[model samples]
Target chain A: MSTTEMTVHAFTRMLERHGADASRWPERQAAERLVVRDAKARQLLEEARGLEDLLRASLPVPNPTAARMRADVRGRLSTGPSQQLIDWFDRGPLWRPLMAALLPLGLGFVLGLGFPEPAADDDLIAAVSLLAFDQGTYLDESLNASVEGGEYAP
Target chain B: MARVQARDSEALEHLMVRHGGALHSYLYRMNPNPSDVDELGQEAFLRVWQHAGRWRPERARFSTWLFRIGHNLCIDRHRKYRWIAPIKTDETVETAEPTSLRRAPDQAFEEEQRRQAVRRAVAELPERQRSALLLCQFHGMSNQQVADILEISLAAVESLLARARRALKEQLVQFINTDQATQ
Candidate 1:
């Protein structure tokens, strides 16, 4: 809107839109300057200015004892990694691939170490061989009888 | 930040000294609860340390990144504890005054009441509007900077600030009118 034609509502909108600082409102500065000359626009700007002042005054300053907060933050920063290690494992990109590769290997190693290979048990080997020998002899006898009968028939 | 990522405590300390106060104040303004403020501040800084490797200066300024951390923490905390007291009754604003000059009891009381009204008006704002107002108006950050921190467009930031200011003006119109009349 043109400066002379700007309404009070429009000026207020401009103030709210661009903020109270004229420098920041480059496009609206000329129009705002003109609007400021009008009584209604001036009143709106004044009220808006007052609100800005209150808003500024309302801001709580940095607590001086916030140094304690700084110290507390530092303390946590010192100890932060251990607590965050799990987070790192879960979210860290490198850790993800590293864990993905290492997990199965680590599990296999643990299982291998936890349960050692039993020393070669002669008794167990002998029992297995005896069973194998008996099955082999039974198969041999059946095959030989089938071969002899086939020879006689043929 | 690279040093922090490298696990340099001194670099982390330097960063904390530089930005911790501002971060704490931002959190306090957002929630005004001391415990929440402290916890969120610590959490934000902690995240900063943890995610130091993720920072890319080309993407955002360090302060913007840091404040984003704090802002996210505030959102998470607010979401988790919806029943926590709002920022309306924060007494920290009273202590924020200069202690060097003592005001009369009645004068201090009136000032406290005014501050309380302003806080309530601000705290009652919607999340984005409140955050926009806090970052832009109170923190003196540019609208573009606020947009970066809040991950909104410049127009959205301006709209948010505009709405927030308009709402604050409406809420405290009586006080603003009186103050102007007195002046």
Candidate 2:
């Protein structure tokens, strides 16, 4: 909206939201005019100006850390995968991470053994024969099956 | 931004040079602890580096996008460390009056008091109010940018700023009165 149409209340609200900086205000001319014509507007502007000044003085100066922050950022960026692992380790207590890692392993192990079925003697013999790379048991099993089917050849 | 998207350190550095001060300042305000400023600021840029490929320049200004990262980090950090006291130690105070204090001791001392009082006042503001004020006042981000960074509505940002300032005006009455008395 144009400055001419702006009221003291609107100007005051604008000052409150955007502060009293005429340059930053959208309706600088209107705000300036309001400040000139309206005494209350002038006072409000003055108060805001004072506040802005105090904030400018009191606000945290980022320059000190800005440079250091840049340097640290560059360093952080330059760090490779191995360094990131070390950095992760540096974040907090070791036991928490250790527990985080171990808890899942423990849970998985318990779940894996939760419903174990007893292996038959034949299954154990088969597993042992396979591990030993013996062809005798396999051949015997194949022959016995062929004989039972009455299809064995001498 | 394209080079940064390609994972170029030089371009990332360039962006940091351009917006690092404002970003650092925003984080410094958001974080109560001064020490976290470095780490948080670094993480903000690091995210820019890692996620530049995700940035859409047509959608938002880089600064807005960058501040949004910083804002999110601030919230997460705040939640992680909810009980942190806002410490305004003299050594941690980075304002200019410290150097000038050697020249005009009395005036500088008074300025220091006001500065600390203002810091205390700002620090004591609720998180969103302080965020709104810093983004708008110091960083020169528009209300929309503030809302975007804060992930709040424009009307909410306006409400936040008014509430923040009203609280400050109340808390700062003593300092204003002190100024008038001095003048």
Q: For candidate 2, lDDT tens digit of each residue in A50-83? A: 7777787677563545567778878887789998
DockQ for candidate 2 = 0.25
Q: Report each candidate's C-alpha RMSD, comma-separated, in the order given.
A: 10.0, 11.0
Q: Give the Å shift of residue B34 in candidate 1.
A: 1.2
Q: For residues A1-154, could you state the per-residue lDDT of candidate 1 as single tens digits?
A: 4445555666666788667766666457555666657887777667778988888877665463556766876775555566667644643345465777799999999889997466668678998999999999999999899898896465
Q: What is the lDDT of residue A32 in candidate 2?
A: 81
CA lDDT of each prediction against the hidden true structure:
0.77, 0.78
List the lowest-lDDT window of 10 residues for candidate 1 chain A: A87-96
Candidate 1 lDDT tens digits, B76-128: 66765575455655444455456778789997787778878988888789999
Model 1 stretches astray by more than 4 angstroms: A1-9, A62-66, A80-82, A85-154, B88-107
> TM-score of each model's B chain?
0.89, 0.88
| Candidate 2 chain A worst ten-residue window by lDDT | A87-96
Which candidate gets the maximum DockQ versus the true structure? Answer: 2
